[model samples]
Target: MGSDALSPEVAARERTLDDLRRRMASVPGRGESATGHIPREQPLRRDLLPVPGPLAELLPDGGLPKGAVVAYSGAHSMLSGLLAAVTGDGGHAAVVGLPRLGLLAAAEMGAQLSRLAVIADPGPDPAEVAAVLLDGLDLVVLGLGDLAVPPARCRVLAARARNRGATLVVAGGTWTNPSLRLDTRVTGYRGLGAGRGRLRSVCLDVRVSAKAGPPRHGRIDLCAQAGRTEWLAREAETREVVDLREAVS
Candidate 1:
């Protein structure tokens, strides 16, 4: 009875994947979907230049959303670098009001000069910059500081991106309107050297909270080189669904 509820959607996705497998089966480095394994198609081509960051490669889609705002933490430099790489590839990207961001470091990660715009103005208005950035670019990167705007505007940007197939990466706080909210956790870190060494490297654990579909969560491992990102699937773990309406007591 429980499996019956999921038959239609699961069957449809399976059929689609089976068809895709048949077409791409001859391709190298690609493997077949094992028994009981759910097939999920990666959004972007995995071969495009990898971004600089340890966790960029581990993301399920191989990168961030091409048209949705993803709120994140300021502590993870690797995460920010990954976002910049996504925006700076083949399209113009705007980094708004993130004064603390090291543009040089981002560039070192993989941000392209011709496709990057860094807006350092610390103004009270977010809509102004958001409007301009949204209109003239394929991607928008904003640092959500202590802003006083309503969530509706964020929703509007999300809707626009979804409609236009553009991607937005929002850092520094919780974005309620995201199609997927990515929460990162550090699994392990390496050492470059002593005293002057950088964050040797780190792994990322992701918890994706979605607005509609079933919330997906998992962990991934990644390593950052001078300007390349490598992602590896660690373990695809299932999450427990708690009913919000149910009483805790």
Candidate 2:
């Protein structure tokens, strides 16, 4: 629905209500009402907003699978903290060789600053950073950059995560390293016309496949600037479906 459909007064009122609901959801230590009869105020946990329909069913936790690697290309900035969000609250995470990301933005995305560690400015070989990641973290985020890491290293990293129950996220660089993979691409929808204000949105198309699990695929609309990441059912035609042949082999 267009924002113009409602009168300015109504729109203002709706926005106020939205803000109040969001604030109430954010209150700390505010559990169910003292009587214990009130329905729990939105299950208390720090999960990612929600998963897209098709992919959600495939995940055991209705989110990204724990202790597995999910990859993204050209949209790292857009889908930051994917691992941490999927890992839930109080989860530990590490970022390797991510030289360009804004640390504050990282914090905003969900990785706790106290729980996060960074391996900055590493050499071209990603294996070096991968080794530290495999040994240290419960969840690891890595940027490929110029590194041409061997396929064997990716396999080993995935195995270590599986063995230790960690989640590995790869973004903005090389892919094609493991038995399972998730490839993502972002498409931006532009707002049109002169009378209406410009409204923009990004759709993240995800293709996820695992050796034993079903080859699942879907697209989720994500709000980048807004703190909330909600699932969008209807949208423009910019989303794309990726073929898994290359990733599976």
lDDT score for residue 111 of model 1: 62
- The 0-to-1 C-alpha lDDT of every candidate, in the order given, reads 0.54, 0.53
Question: Candidate 2, residues 1-249: lDDT per residue as tens digits?
Answer: 785599776666556545534533442221222243332233322332233444464444566554667665555544454533432344445566776766665555564565556656544554445555545355667777755556777677778867755566777565555544666665444232334344344456666667676776666654445654444533447443223342223
Question: How would you encode candidate 1's per-residue C-alpha lDDT over 74-112 as one tens digit per residue?
Answer: 345554566455544444456777877776666655666
Q: By summed lDDT, which 10 consecutive residues of candidate 2 come out lowest?
A: 27-36
- The 10 consecutive residues of candidate 1 with the worst lDDT sum are 240-249
Give me the overall lDDT of model 2: 0.53
Off by over 4 Å in 2: 1-61, 77-79, 83-88, 102-106, 172-179, 190-200, 212-214, 224-249
